[model samples]
Target: MILHDFLPSGNGYKIRLLCACLGLNVTLKEYDITKGETHTESFLAINPNGKIPVLELDNGQCLSESNAILLYLTEQNHLTQQHQSALLPADPILKARVYQWLFWEQYSHEPNIASPRFWLTHNAMTDLKKRMLPDRIQQGHVALKLMDDTLAQHTFLVGDAMTLADICLFPYTHVAEEGGAYQLSEYPNIQRWIKQIEALDWFIPITQG
Candidate 1:
């Protein structure tokens, strides 16, 4: 399998981390998104949307969208049933909760957190991007506070262990202060949850050269 990705992208990092945890050896094809690499004809043929983190399977099929790829990979790993139950639980309702968080991350969380981080850390600060900051921070805090309140009651998002939801949400939230310009220290439960995720045996850092 070939994983087309841009390192430093939290979306891509989620796949990399999951592959590592599953002990899957997938060839990584790095692209510089800033150079319009993802927009190339070859890449567009693979995923017309021109998104990074496209997974080309051994059978010559391609999958796009980070979370979808994550679900695919996790579903492919049969060992997860005995070892990584939280990833995709057998219970229908438990699995639904994981999906709930995944959707919320893309809609409610990433818009405010990841989008702002890209503009603040990677893109040139233009008038429009600059103008978007206040609203992003406001919405970002709402997401963080909600997570904090939920986490104050549980160690992980779903059942007893970290699920797909936690992995999906962790990267953006961990780096929230960089984009939102609000200290994570203010959310003590979030800080504690961050530490818990970091302590996982197969975890990988988001930072990459």
Candidate 2:
């Protein structure tokens, strides 16, 4: 398998982190999105949407969307294990909960937190984005608070054991303060959660392939 990704991207990092946890060996194809590398003709052939983190399988099929790739990888792993994988539970209710968090991250969390971080840190800010920043930051706090409140009750997003939900949210949430849009110190539960994830043996930094 090959992961077409940008190292700094949380979306890309999601797949990388999961592969690490699953002990999967995947070749990394790096792209500099800042330089319009993903928009090139060859890259466009891989993903017409021109996004990074497209996972090309051994048979040459490509899967886009980070959470979808997470599910695919976990499901594939489950098939081999022939039992419930801690990353994605087999029970319907538990699996639904994991799905809920993944959807929420894209709709409520990523736009608010990830976009602002990209705009500010990558020098991609514009007049419109400047006007949008305050509201985005406010919503980001709301998202963070929700996660913090949830984590306050459980060791991971869905339950005591870590799940795909935690991996989906961790990338951006852990580095949210980079663009000054957030202060991680304000979310103590989240801080503790971040530390716990970082200590995992298979944990890989966002920049690691």
Candidate 3:
């Protein structure tokens, strides 16, 4: 499989991390979105929206969206589930809870962590006009508080063990501190959990280039 991604992007990190964990043989194709590469006619043919982390299969089929890619890559693997309690809850109610957090990650989490990171860390001052500072800071803290509160109780998000939920949320979240909102020191459970993830054999620090 050929995975076209932005090497520095969290969305791309999601797939790269998953590939490493699953031992999938995926060729990495890095694209420079900052240079308007995604907008090119050829890339738009593969994905009309023109985004990075576009996974193209051997048959020439393509998939976009990071979460979708994660599910696709890991679902059938032995490590498809590491800790069910934290990620894939066994109980119907708890499983639903896991999904809730996963959904929240995409909806509530990324807007806060990823968007602001792009503007503050990557983009030029001219790009600043497009960002909504008040909303970004507001929503980012909201997500952080939710994580801090829930993580205060347990070492992991959904259960005692790390699950897919953690993988889904960790990318944007771990870097939320850059947005000036993350205080992992205040959430000891989360701090411990971060360490655990880092210790995994397949784990790759997304922050590193």
| Candidate with maximal TM-score | 2
Weakest ten-residue segment in model 2 by summed lDDT: 77-86
The digit string of per-residue lDDT tens for model 3 on 1-209 reads 99888877888887787777666788888788889889899999988999988989889999998877776765545453442332354578876777788788889988777877776677533545455766777787788778878887886787667766788877777676764545556656666677788888878887433
lDDT accuracy of residue 198 in candidate 1: 88
Query: Tens digit of lDDT per residue, candidate 1, span 33-94?
Result: 87899999999999999988899999999999989998999899845654456487878999
Decoy 1 TM-score against native: 0.94
Report the alpha-carbon TM-score of model 2 versus the true structure: 0.96
For candidate 1, the per-residue lDDT at 20 reads: 71
What TM-score does candidate 3 get on C-alpha atoms?
A: 0.85
Query: How well does each candidate superpose onto the true structure, as a TM-score?
Result: 0.94, 0.96, 0.85
> Which window of ten consecutive residues has the lowest lDDT sum in model 3?
78-87
- The superposed Cα distance between candidate 3 and the true structure at residue 70, in angstroms, equals 1.2
**Which lDDT value does model 3 have at 42?**
92
After superposition, candidate 2 runs with Cα above 4 Å error: 79-85
| Higher-ranked by lDDT: 2 or 3 | 2
Q: Once superposed on the true structure, which residue ranges of model 3 sit more than 4 Å away at CA? A: 78-91, 125-131, 179-187, 207-209
